[model samples]
Target: MHNDVEEILFSKEDISRKVKELGEKISKDYNRDDEVVVVGVLKGANVFMADLIREIDIPVYIDFMAVSSYGYSTESSGIVRILKDLDLEIEGKHVLIIEDIIDTGLTLKYLTDNLKSRNIKSLKICTLLDKPKRRKCDLNIDYIGFEIPDKFIVGYGIDYGEKYRNLPYVASLKEETYK
Candidate 1:
């Protein structure tokens, strides 16, 4: 895996610090609310979701939503479908959408819209990485850890062909290996 990595972008410490910061801000923003619900996009956001939830010292709830936007590819299909939906109703609840990365913006957009239609009191996105270079939809990400270039990164719960998500840190994959 080291041989295939071109560069180590985000070390484990760096990510941990950022996640803590983001959690602090989120806790502040939702302090007045009765129920603060965090909905994490599945698989990739799984690790971040766990870490972020622990950082918040306030009372909060967590849920998962699995979205299928891309399948072992960098390009998005411009369609969003739910592989797994949230079990709890977020109607009239403060909702935070946690994601691993925001690339095309399609998935997040779709997610926000769906949540909005459900009468959630508020909806905002929090992503670890913001890849504006590849965004296809008009985007706004509330909490962002890093603004990264257009690179296929795997680790910290991100993946390629369902591989590399368990790496301790974030690393850019070599093009030759995937192409």
Candidate 2:
């Protein structure tokens, strides 16, 4: 797995520090007495959500949504599908969507729209990484840990064919690995 990486963009320590910082900001922003619903976009966001929620000081209810625009591919198909939906009813609840990375904004936009129609009290987005250059639609991302270059990265919950998610840090994979 290590050899497959062309370069390491962010180390484990770097990610940890950023997660802690994001958690602090989130805790400060939503310091209300009521618990907030922290929705994790499944598979990729699982690792990020776990670390982030631990840093949050306020009470939080966790749930997962498995939405996909990429299936065994690096580029987005521009078609979004929800493989799994939130188990908790988010109506009238403050909801925060946690994402591993936001590249094209298609999946998140679709998801935010879907969640908004549910009549949730409020909705915000937080992502571990963002590639604004590739955005196809405008989105208001409330929290962002890093603005990365246009590169296909894997590790730290991100993956290529489900093989690199176990890596401890984010890295760009060798072209041959994915090609």
Backbone collision count in every prediction?
0, 0
C-alpha RMSD of each candidate structure in angstroms: 1.2, 1.0
What does candidate 2's lDDT look like per residue over 1-179, in tens digits? Answer: 49999999999999999999999999999866865899999889999999999999998999999988898988899999899999998888999999999999999999999999998889999999999999999999999999999988999999888889989999998989888
Candidate 2 lDDT at 73 equals 83
Alpha-carbon local distance difference test for all models: 0.88, 0.94
What's the TM for model 1?
0.96
lDDT of 1 by residue, 1-179 (tens): 47778789999999999999998998887765468788999989998898999988888788999998888776788878899999888888889989999998999989888888998777888999999998888867889999999988889999888888888899999889688
lDDT of 2: 0.94
Which regions in candidate 1 have their CA more than 4 angstroms from the true location?
none
